[model samples]
Target chain A: MLAAGLLALSAGSSAATDGYAAIDGGTFRSVLPAGPGIEQVDVAPFRLAKTPVTNAQFLAFVQKHPQWRRDRVAGLFADQSYLQSWANPVVPGAGAPADAPVVQVSWFAASAYCESVEARLPTWYEWEYAAAADETRTDARSDPAFRARMLSWYARTADTPAAVGKGPVNAYGVFDLHALVWEWVSDFNALMVSTDSRDQGEDPDLLKFCGAGAITMQDKENYAVLMRIAMLSSLQGAYTTANLGFRCARDGDEP
Target chain B: MRSIRRLLRAMAASCLAVTFSVTAQDLPDDSVYQLQVPLRTQADTASTLDRWRGHPVLVSMFYASCGYVCPLLIRSTQKLDRDLDAAVRRNLRVILVSFDPDHDTPEVLAALSAKHGIDDTRWMLARAEAGDVRKLAAVLGIQYRKLPDGGFNHATIISLLGPDGRVLATTSNPSHPEAEFVAALRATAVASKTPAAP
Candidate 1:
């Protein structure tokens, strides 16, 4: 993401809450990128959930809504493969509580939950920052610090489902960001496409994310920046990972 | 002088207003609007988006191992970078997030970022939690299905997010032209700085 002003901007539809994000002008200027459609997502400072959405919270939503429950709303989530595993209740009971984060949800389902609560998903950047934050830490489980913390957290508890406990939060005061289950974000396809809101009228040839052909490069440390951008982009919207879960964000009293 | 200040502010506001389309009213039932996607922390992750919170961003998605779509996507990204207004480019940061966390190792991601002359400053490759991946795909209106080959058969969609991580607009694949991205950059160029609270 790049740094910009706090002014309101409109790309296409003018229906939701909007705000300006920032970027590191110097860093952004120093490097070159793959072919160009990209969005510099601004991740403003805000409260992030301590842990991944748990089964309990999901159960609560299902219980109250009834419509969102697995039995009630069939075929509303991930591909059948993902659905199948979750199809059988891993947990004995179905009703979930509000304190736990929701699980077994697809991005599609998470998004709907956020919307119903009048909140939105965090951009991957924001989620990552909250989940694993070290001026130097980038990804989770891989980072020694992150991994160590996760191991310790897990060590204290059994593999069985559990609620988050009181613990130190990140620099931003987000709870259980790293040790808990993975949290969902809004910008998953950070590497694959070139997207722009300002240049709606520009020619069509410049967009980068529309599907690039192939990329083969090796050398590691020397290319971390490029790699970072591309890695985020490489993801698709259909992915389903057991570790992944989600949280939501909301604009100040705008609705 | 007052008029000039107003002009500058107006120009900046207009820039944001022109590019930032999301409002509280637009976002409703966020759940089930699209497919159920999953996300995981990438093996090799990049810098934080917090670094770019206040700037316009150009983004793309691709796996390092992709034989075709990934390459084309990088090429397009390069073309857009080359074509962006110098001013917009100065204020812009372009990043790539990978979908394949398992294979997109830090080394693989770095090499992929570099193969196309991408440097760390502006361009990058990061990982996503499966949940985050799904939510992002939905917001951008992108869809994909895993292929038997351990790859994905996903639509190509280009997206722009305001400094605040809000979706500005998108360009679907098979039709992304370079000029569109440049225009997106321009839309965000004049806004006042959304510098992270120091």
Candidate 2:
């Protein structure tokens, strides 16, 4: 009985360390066009969690903030599938390990979790800059081998559940950016590329954007990055999915 | 039996009183007003999003410098007002908050208000802090980004909020008002005017 209780309790509380590593930000070429004259995007220095927040950590959070529990969370903040994988509101079901990265969470829930820790979600530029690194070099986009590895992960079926810290850490000590799951960025909605269909001979929704028209994607060949952008832009704030999780970032310059 | 009936009436009256005095603690868990962020109106007054809590509101996000779509958005809102009966329209208010606070200051908002001939009595042009802007947009489901030309690319949506500050309906069809959306607005307007039953 004691062993069973220990196991159940283990799935609710793990190490409290948020594992934040400071990232040095600079001007970098991004696949998304940096508004006209700006040739490169400039990211400010910030600290990112070395790994995505875990199921155990989130369970503890939900237990503490009952308003965020799946059963009690307001419809304005989350959809029906929010926390659908959990057996109960406070416990992860079978096949869900304590150390596995938490998935099926809405942007609001993720933001609240970050706030509870006095942190925030990483902006798109900051996340992209951090993920550009490999095990050795900081900017590994020119490396064909690095690109191939990232593409292979995308090519594979994402049905397999991911556990945190299993993959090799990058040069900045950040882990599982590409291989684990699609992470939520703070400006997910800001990636609007216009999908209004009324004006187009093609699918009207495809061209239905307001303002200066559809954002011209820069590096079209970078399907990996473009796919992430498409996925992020398509979702609303209250949406959640099986293969989407998030990590937290802080506004600090510490390396 | 008469005493029992009188006691129930008294209990119901107390419930009505409790609802009327909606303290901060009484705000619904799902209320958009729970955001608790400050906003400045074109009148140079500081208020939160829930200031219009006692009335139904049509809320959207826009920037003052937006040349094309914003004008259409304003025209659409005006059209919505025209579609409603005078009685229903009287209880309704329109709020257009700016996503670009850096450019859309109170002075800029006031200028746009004049340029558009916005009826200040029913319509408000407001700006919130940058941090609050994101939270407001998230609640309203409006997405926007600053462009290289100092312009913005955004999705256009207008949401209808009931008196308690919960979203009653939303419409992305700014140029053409949907019949169902207008009906929801009319219903909310009528509902707001009705006295609380005790």
Best by lDDT: 2
lDDT of 2 by residue, A154-227 (tens): 88886657678878889888889898899999888788653332232343223234566556667666677888
**In terms of DockQ, which candidate is strongest?**
2
Predicted candidate 1 versus true structure: per-residue lDDT over B57-167, tens digit per residue: 766566777786678787766776776666666777776666666677777766766677775677666666554554445555565433335575456676776776555
Per-candidate DockQ vs. reference: 0.05, 0.28
Residue-level lDDT of model 1, residues A1-255, one tens digit each, is 222222223222111212212221111111222223322223445544434555655554444443344433323244343323243433424333333445446665566566555567776545544544433432332455555555465445434444553345444435555455555566554333233323323444443322332222222232333334454355444444544567775432333
The C-alpha RMSD in Å for every predicted model, in order, reads 20.6, 7.7
The TM-scores of all predictions, comma-separated, are 0.39, 0.82
